[model samples]
Target: MPHRRCSLWLVSALIVPLAAGCDDSAGHDPADDLPADAAAADRGSDVSPADAAAADSGRDGWIDGDGPDASGDPPAADAGTSSSDEDGGVDAGPTLDCGARTECAGRCVDLATDGAHCGACEAACDASEVCLEGACTAGPVEAWTVDFDFGGGESALVEDFAVDAEGNLYVVGTGRAAPYRTLPGSRAGGFVERWDTDGTLGFRQVMPHLEATGASPLGVAAGEAGRYYVIGSTVGAYPFDATHASAPEDRGYVAAYDAHHAIEWLITTDLVASRQLERHGDRLYAVMRGQEANAFPIELEGVRFTTDDGIGFDWFTIALTTAGAVRWGHGSDTDDRANGLAVLADHVVRAGYHTIATGGGLSSHRYQLDALDHDGTTLDGYDDFGVPGGSAVAEGGGVVYVAANGPDGWVLQRYIDRTLDWERALGEAVHVSDVVVDARGRAYLGGTLSGAHSFDGEHLGEEHDGWVAAFDAEGGLRWVDIVDNPAGSLWVVMKEVEVSLASGLVYYRYRVTSRDGERVVALRQPE
Candidate 1:
């Protein structure tokens, strides 16, 4: 049935604790968490009947008590789990009206206007509350709300999501409507959806229009201030002419949106958009996947933005200088997908994932974190952050935090730009997807959690909640908020997490269905 909750507890309490005890006394170093059953069998110990049963029952029978703790191979590095894994509406429901039968943050407050419970179940409220512009009230809104149902079956995978200084939630996902499930009036869109920071359903459009009628908006990036940008391949339409999009095919596409969710302009080039999008300074970069015609590595490009009247059109391509036109092409890594990139202290930090040997017994793909010049040319410094694959990085003070899925499970690790500082394992269960750090140095990690970690960052806080988990700069976990079950799978988790400094709230663009309806709960740092 559903991964037995009893089994989950056993792994945590009985198993993990006993394993830790064995490590201390035996003085034997693990090649990183060799299953208890396997380790014990190697020791040739006497096993009880029930113990053998447990081992057999857990982890595909790879359990010490049951079997050799099944699915081994250094914990299947969670890769592109296409397989795995709400919101603000248009003012259609009643005003401040909620059912009292629902269970909330320890009380039966009205789901509507109850300062404590805004939308639905168990979403508790803090003490002194205030109402902002969302579907709920304020008081440091923990509002993470999203509605994901682009018409069923066809799922929208948000590669990256972020919010502007104005509190607008920008989500970048790949799906279709024409053949799949498009919006009501749209032909069938392969576009991005932009929601107001206050959870309003105002802005939605085809991310990047195509001229050849072939491509769609591929990659997207957002800045800390008021700018939003996306990259793709398409000889798309210009702001002046909707009729212009029916021409030819464009490669490296770049589109700019202002704080009001209005498109400024659209520019098309020649970059096969493979990964997502990233931004450092004023420079916007999009990394294309696949090899080039010359049999070289992948391609990379960046474009600069300038405003033309209210609509931002006309900008220079950063990959080359427009003055006299010089071919100062960008660089790429051995890996196909663009792992991540960041700008710190005038030094541009770029990272990618590569598969290599580690400790002989275990060899897998980890991350490559590097520092380059502002022009995206000069390589300053970099290293393998011990994570099996390249990941998103954030630099503050002297430490840089990376969110990655490595040899272990999920990790929100910190490095000193040069040295590997620390990596506190977030989920003792699965892998982590994205990591972000705030101006206050508070670190937030988004991934699938088997259970919640203690707010004090000690042990597994609760057996509930699998998806959203947050940790501090010191690697201490703050909270783990459960989203919902997918179909019949309870372990189904949330992926991308976008935090807003303006409201001190976190927004996860992934979709989760509750009882009566779908919701995106904005979980706050508990007070």
Candidate 2:
């Protein structure tokens, strides 16, 4: 049978205090829970004469006078009240008090374990809900989540994501497709899928081109009128000769997909690697990393290439019209690569890190951010942000916010007019993986943390959990919430975080592992 409801009620009441149990064990032994005859059978002795005489009068062998008769039945009435020794017969046992205000879906149920009223009332779970590790989660999670191992049993990784104006999600990743388009280990192709606002799968497609080695979709951006673009580097020919560059074996590609999921256009470039892409107005700006300057031709308009003598790489930005026409480009010979990009009304910002020659003939990296004018010229640049491993950029309330991860911790910087306004760190030693800035100038940060950490005076417990915190424009923390895993399990790691501008809902994706197995979960923060 299922775990006894009595045990569940006992544990739930002890933890939450929503219910209370009757304490009838002050003078009772653990053996009192067993039946009288069963207890006697374990004694290996017949009932004594005195005990039999007492049972004949009004009691059984039980110490209390409220046990069953020798025949396992309640005793007859002696006066206005009856003397009985049965579990539920003639007041033989005391009543249990579960609490006075337990309610769920208009029915009395345990909130700690009830699927229909987990954590709060009316928060019904559509699928199976299990209270594992002190938190309630529904199986086969539906919303704000995409599990790569859901059905195909293939190992996959989510690379890039884009959210549309209507709160829909577009995700691209690399993995072997199933049933429809199957590729072997080294020949895996890129896959893209869209999720509607209600968490339903809209469509799924695998890139038709196959690479001899592999390909990964590194960036995605949503544009006007529901259109979107997918960009990545390919290891083999892309099949479309008209769009591929002279040497198609190793190149980067940018493909546009219409609102109806139809392929509109495809283009290839000599750039060997592409990291990120951002759409502004009627144009797209892509950060491309190249190894040799000779690989790019000067005749290609809006296309600039720079190289560090083939010893290091050059990072640059290429602007292209919606119709795949190059507009403007800028290149730099620094030993760095751009990781993030954001466009504003008057300036375009790129955030990344560069390797610098240090003392002792060594080299170290430093974070860099540059503001470029419309003509692809650097108007201003800042390089004192520290060494960053990954970064993201956003604009809100005319202020630009850049969140990055470094050796120290997570650093968030706010800038106005290419000048620093303020900067803050999450804590002394924690990893902040991703951040999102809403239109109201509210910043949300997500990462992994251990031990007790305080954010803006809000205390998080001394446990390993996924943490998401919100802060106002003035760098004041608003709230911090923890998404804990099962006890004794490894700490939770955040993979992605995004907020829907249209719904004001914050979505985060995290992964956790326990003795039971591994799980990738997507959860929404309650308002």
Candidate 3:
């Protein structure tokens, strides 16, 4: 069962009172009184009784009650209706007969339609939201959320997520081994989970653990024809294939799966790690980083790529066919790191940081963006943003947006045809993890905030809060939303943000430092 958080409702003048028909006959179902569209939006039949019980436990800020007397137990019917028991203690009044409604604070509330108690006892919908089929939704937009955990004492880290053409979501992460015996002496392995458009989990495949010490899937991309790809690094022999054993060093692997979750093809490389993967049309592009000295004269797709001196780390970008055959591969012999990758109509863009050795043995980092032809030829110059790298890149409508950390704060720059279009400085103390653009030329950035910072007019400076913000093509701020962490959690960081082309909904994947493993939230783009 998937865990869900009930939408919050403002308690001031915006609170909508419960319907008077809630106190009707005992057998009356409140759903019948709802509007035709609202009644059709109800998804209560999809939630099992165990799921409802779990939601009642108040897991992810969805409390079961509202005030001091908001316990799961029913309150006294009247203030003076209590009676004394045989032991001289005051006995509480009889529980209210709410019929089909739930008793919250001594009042009967229809959980299915009551905005004040939408899904749980005293749970409230947002001010702009209405209770529909036990879930809070904003008009025609359906809110989808799910929380995933591996098991007890096991930690899971969500790396990336992608939405398929059918609106199904796929999340890739790594899970630490639990105390119980599964494959003895295994440390950790990777996993991929899929959720359908209706917020139901389709499948979860935990990778087979052989004798590998660590296996982490760092990136994922959804392709055509119900195909998806996962790229990661592993130690010891590759866990996905036993026939092709690798040395004890870190090796990168990319695996393609069909609609039935069966592996269609797998490719392993001598590279250290795979940073990012993007699929565009009939081709797939990926960027990887590794030390050339570790594996000299690396062979990828029968092509030999050798570094200049094998002294510094190098980054490689490769284009591959849908059948896992490499078409072209390009490598850079420098101390550079791969942060983001995006494919355009005629070029593949790579964004990251490059380290330059200054005088007196000091090194300085500068943001680097490179454009390459589809045949692995480097295009002429790209404008230097003069900021530190570690940036993320996204493309939409032939324009590219890069988000990087600048001396003043975080900078978002727009580029067209390798030329600077415009730039904006977001506040300081903010680190951007990923940036994505929707089909409508709207760019969205997701990251964590440390100190006080302002996004347009909204202010969010919580210690470690996750946030997502949107921007128009003309560099105007749309809106920003702060994804507050649950109480008592160590921190929360948004790892990736993806826009569903089919549904036009934005999905955010974040990790909470609490016992809750990872959470995926979907929201419709506001008009």
Highest-scoring model, TM-score:
3
Clashes per candidate (backbone, < 3 Å): 40, 2, 3
Instruction: Please give the distance, in angstroms, between residue 253's alpha carbon in candidate 2 and its true position after superposition.
Output: 1.0
Best by lDDT: 3
Residue 462 in candidate 2 has what lDDT?
43
Instruction: Name every residue pair that clashes in candidate 2.
Output: 67-85, 68-85
Residues forming the 10-long window of minimal summed lDDT in candidate 2:
2-11
Q: In lDDT terms, how accurate is model 2? A: 0.50
lDDT of 3 at 235: 55
Task: State which candidate, 2 or 3, has the greater TM-score.
Answer: 3
Score residue 127 of candidate 1 by CA lDDT. Answer: 37
Q: At residue 332, what lDDT does model 1 achieve?
A: 39
lDDT for 240 in candidate 3 is 45
Mark the regions of model 1 whose C-alpha exceeds 4 Å error after superposition: 1-144, 154-159, 174-186, 207-212, 223-227, 235-249, 258-265, 294-329, 336-339, 355-364, 378-384, 396-399, 404-409, 450-465, 484-487, 511-521
Better of 2 and 3 by lDDT: 3
